[model samples]
Target: MTELRDVDFFRDPNSVVSPYSYMDDLVQNSPVWIEPNYGVAMVAGYDEALTVMRETETYSAAPMIAGPTPDYGVEFTGDDIDEQLDAVRHRLPFNDQIVAMDPPQHTMRRALIMGLITPKRLKENEDFIWQLTDRQLDVVLPRGGCELVDDYAQPYALLVVADLLGVPEEDHPMLLEKAGVAANGSLTDTTKEPPKKHGGLEHFYEYFTDRVESRRREPKDDVLGRMAHATFPDGTLPEPLEAARIASNLFAAGQETTVRLLATALQIVGDDQGLQQKLRQDRGLIPKFIEEVLRWQGPIKGNMRVARKTTTLGGVHLKAGTQVFVMHGAAGRDPRQFDDPQGFDIERPNVRRHIAFGHGIHTCPGAPLARSEVRVTLERLLDRTSAIRISEAHHGPPDARRYDYLPSYMFRGLTKLHLEFDMEA
Candidate 1:
C-alpha cells in the first residue's frame, strides 16, 4: 500500500496533473478516509459528500480553505471559539466573503446575494447571453482556430458575470485580472509557504470599497445598484466593508468556475466529433449534454468543510475542528450514485442531481447564469462551425491526446484548448 505521505493529493503538481485517476484510487480504498498527508478527512462518495453538506450543523463551512488559516501575525489566545474565530477573521485578508460564514450570517449574506441576482435580472441576463456569445464568436470565428480558454471561455465567463454585476465595460479587464488573482490565490499549493495575507484580497477590498461607496451615493439602474441598495432582512444596509465583501465575492466566485465548466465542455465536444455532431444536430439536447458534461467533468474538484463537533461519518470518527474535504468530482463518479459513472451519457435521467455546483446552502448561487453561458456558448459555436476538432499539432494524436489541467487540486480545467473548426458556409 502506498503511504499517505507518499501521496500528496493536493500539493504535488505532477500528482494533480491527472487527479481523477488518483481520486479513483483514493475513493476505492474508502469513501471517507483520513488522508495521512494532511490528516484531513476526505469524503469521496456521493452519499457521503451529500451527508456532510446537508448536515451543516455537524460540518461548518467556516474552514473552506484547505490548510491552516495563514498566521497573519495574530495569535488568538482565548477559550471562546467564536471570539477566537472573529479575531482570526479580522486579521485575514478576505474574511467577510459569504463562503466562510456560518448559519445566521451566511443565511443573511446569501439572501442579499440572491436578491442581487433575482429572477427578473436573470431573465434579462439570459436574453443578453446570445449577444455576448456572438461578440466572442465574432472574434474567434474569423481566425481558423484558437485557444479556447484564453480566447473564448475565460473572457465570456468574466464578461457575463461583469455584465450581471453591472461592472462598467471599461473596468471589466481590470476587475477580471484582480478577481482571477484572488480566485487562484485561494487554492492551497503545498509546495510553498502560505502567505500571511493574499494580495488579491487587499486589491479587491480597495477596488470594491470605491465601487460600493460610489453606488451608494448614486444608485444606477443595474445589478450593482440593486446590491448597493439591498438591505439585510432586518431592513438595514450592509456596511461599506460588507458591501465591498459581497461585490468582490460575487466578482471572484462567479467567473472562474464557469470558465472551467466552459473549457471542459468545449474540450469534451471538441475531442468527440460524434458527440459534438449529435448535440449540433439536435440543439434541444444541448442542455442535457451540458448537464452530463458537468457530471463527468465539472469545474470544481472538491470543497473543504470542518467538523463542528465530534461526529462519525462513513464509520470513521472525526473530532471537532477536523477539516473535511468533500470530493465532488469523485462523488460524481461513485457507482452507487450513477450507473457506469465514468461513461458520459446525455440521456441519463438523473444527471442533474450531481453536485457539480455543490449541494445544500452553499450551492453556487450563480448556477443559473453558468448554465446559460454554457448553453449559449454551445448554441453559438455549433451554429458557427460545421465541425470542431482538437488541434493534433498541440494535443498530439487522438490515441495519445495531450492536455494540461490547472495545477490546483480544487479546480479542474484545461489550461489551454487548441481547436480546429470548419466554418459554416
Candidate 2:
C-alpha cells in the first residue's frame, strides 16, 4: 500500500486532518499543482493565491464554485451559469447571494449588507452578546464537561446571528437545523436534500419579507427592519426579493462559518493548557487570538473560481472554461508567505495577511461578525473553565485527537470537537 503524500491529503480533506503537511513541498516543488481527481488546478502558495484574488482582471471570481444556482422561480440561470445544470442549481439560494457575485453588482449587494452590521451596530451587540453568552454558559457550565461543538459552538453561532438578524428566539432551533443540513452538504454527501429544500430559503424570504412589510407598516430600530426600509443613493431600495435573498445568505453563510471557528478555537486552546492560561489571564487578547486561530485553523478550506479568458498562472496556461481551486488553508502555511509557516504562533507578525476571509471584491462581509462571536465566546468560556484538555485516552482512541475534518472540497471544519475541562477551581 502506498503512503499518504501531501497532495493526497487534499484528495479526501475530510479524512486528512492536517492540510498543511504538504505546505513546504508545495511551496518549493509545485505551488500550482493541478489535481486530476477534482478536475481543477489547486493554488497553494500565498503569493499565487493573492495573485488570483488581486488580479481579478486575469482571474475572475464570478464563478467561485461550480454547482447549480437557485431558480426560486426567478429567471437568473443562464447568464452566469451553465444551462444544463439549471434544474440542480435552481435549488441553491447562493446564486443571488454576495459570495457568488462579482464587482459592480457585487458592490451594490455588499453595500446593503455592510449597512446593517455597521460599527455602531457591532458596538450595540457587545452587551447583548455577552449577556447571551452568559445565558448559554449558565446552562452548559454546570455540566462540568460537554461536547463543545454540540453544546456550545452550535448554539452560540445560531443565537449570535439570530440576535443580530432579529430571528425570534422560538424559531431559531428549526431555522438552525434547516440551515445546518444545507451547510453540512458542502462537507458531506448526507446533505443531498435539505429537509426544506427551497423551503429553508423560502422561509427566510418570508421572514425577511414580513420584516420589510412590518418596517413599512411601522419602522423598528433593528438592522433587519432598517434594511427593510433602506434605499440606495439613487433612491432605489433593493427590491423586496433581493433584500430577502441577502438576508437569507447572511444567516446561512455567517452561521456555519462562525460555528466552525468557535469549535476549532476551543479545540486548539482546550488541548494546550498554556495557551488557555494566556487567554484566560488577559481577556483582551482573545480577539487577537481569534485572528491568529483563523489563520492557524479556519473553517473554510478553499475558494473556487472560473477562468474568464486564457491566462497564465504559476507558468501554466489556463483556458476560459477552466476551474481554479485556490487552497486558502494550504496557502496560510506557505513558507514563502510566512516564516516557519507551520508554527501556530498566535503573536506572529503579518498574520492579518492570511486569506481566511478571502480577498478582493468578494471578501467576506460577515468577517467582523464572526470575529465578535469567537472573541466573546472564548472570553466567557475561559472565565468559567480553569483548564481544558482532550478527554483521557482510555475513554477513546489516541488518534481521536486529530480534528475529524469535513468531507467537502469547498469548506473544511471540525465534525466533532470533544474536550474535558476542570472547573473545580
Query: lDDT by residue for model 2 over 83-200, one digit each (tens)?
Result: 3333343344355667766565677777877777778877876767898888877876776666666667766665677677767677766665654532211222335764754335
Which residue runs does candidate 2 get wrong by more than 4 Å? Answer: 1-16, 67-93, 168-200, 393-402
lDDT of 1 by residue, 239-285 (tens): 87788777667656767788889888888898898998899889999
Q: Quote the positional error of residue 322 for candidate 2 in Å.
A: 1.0
The deviation in Å at residue 286 for candidate 1 is: 1.0
Candidate that would win on lDDT: 1
Q: Please state the error at residue 231 of candidate 2 in Å.
A: 2.2
Which ranges of candidate 1 are over 4 A from the true structure?
1-6, 68-87, 90-93, 170-204, 219-221
lDDT of 1: 0.78
